[model samples]
Target: MDNTTTEDTSDTEEEILVYAEFADSVNIEKYNSMHILGIDTKTPIVQMNETFFTGTYENPLGTYMFFENDTSPQSTDPVFDRIPEKNVKYVCKTRKLLKVEHGYITPKDGSGQSTQNQAQQAQEDAIKMVSFKTVQEALDKFKQEWCTNESSSTDNNINNLKES
Candidate 1:
């Protein structure tokens, strides 16, 4: 009773060149969009893609191209020359957990009693760790902190607070 054809599966694996924005550094707001060999290659497409959108979805910072396993002479495009021959995987497909830690001192310890000080210190040491199954989940957590709507400032402020 299977109606699905092999074409469906083929489409998923078919390799096509993809141009995407990648994060230049840890800052999420910074991105370098470029054209690269697609997921079909042995490149780390997952990691590259994650880096592209790691921080904010604001604007592109620059442009860069990466091609793995290419030994030929450099192309006229300067971006193409940036590609490294070894360890050029652009994406990571591994299922790894992303962890974020948060900690805060208790405000009730304003009097600064010895016991309260100890408790406050302990509370600060007690970090809350959140793990995400995917990079998108992690990105979403950051996106949730900001107002995405341009028309409604009130709604933006109300929902901008960090979720408990």
Candidate 2:
């Protein structure tokens, strides 16, 4: 008889998390545009029902977007700045985006739990755990890298066409 235990070793890396808070729907549109234009690639893992947005960052320890709100949760770092006071609505940590059933976003996991239950769980986990400085930093870098060059070339071509 042999009484031995084998340990499981895997090479899976942990997913990075970032938190962002937008003041309104316009800011959310800007964020979506930046994402579509390839300016921001962190791909939101979860978005709270309200303004909070959370995603994965390539370098979590380095520069990343950070949200600040007096009524929100506090992290270990002192890099965040408090802004207008407002109670947080929800915090979602799941990787998949919420399904849109009809006109409203639904949390239909399709597993075994009820949609309401899943949504409640996501909301409960929506507090800001990690801090980032500014989401604009990454967008600015992306614009400088891709948008500027492309726009300049496009303008040059348009001017040349007009001259011809």
Candidate 3:
């Protein structure tokens, strides 16, 4: 029956996909990307095939070489020694390679960034502790005391009143 055939075909396709995934997992350790190998630093990334490049991989020399296990995410490591040359390869300039030499790419949060965040939090805490008796009184006092500069007119008036 047609229904029976359809179910069998669907089950077969599912099994094929699972088998392919399992096969890829087995070879995962051997696979590495041209980018993770630091090939992008020295060489440009390109796709040569006019056909759809569903999955692609290359060595340092621009050769078309597919890894046995390419299911893993791209690598973060920064070096590669082998690349193959391909006929359809195209080349273009790339961004400056980030110097990852001195452990520049790291997991540590920046001390300065965190320091500023803490300082801001402390400032907010200090502001919350201020218990002004009244807004108008606070504002009047703030205006009189905010400027450290001496007022010559006020000084002269104070002297006149003192002499009187």
Candidate with best TM-score: 3
RMSD of each: 24.5, 26.8, 17.8
For residues 1-164, what per-residue lDDT tens digits would candidate 2 score against the true structure?
99999889879886544334332343344344232111145444343234333333332333443344446555555667554356453433433222111122456565566767889899999994644478666544544666456878865664565469
For residue 164, what is the lDDT in candidate 3? Answer: 90
Global lDDT of each model?
A: 0.44, 0.46, 0.39
**Best-matching candidate per lDDT:** 2
lDDT of 2: 0.46
Any idea what lDDT model 1 has? 0.44
TM-score versus the correct structure, for each prediction: 0.19, 0.18, 0.21
Pairs that collide, model 2: 65-132, 66-132, 91-126
Candidate 2 or 1, higher TM-score: 1
Tens digit of lDDT per residue, candidate 1, span 44-66?
22332233222222222333344
Residue-level lDDT of model 3, residues 32-77, one tens digit each, is 4313232223422322222111222222322322234333334355
Better of 2 and 3 by lDDT: 2
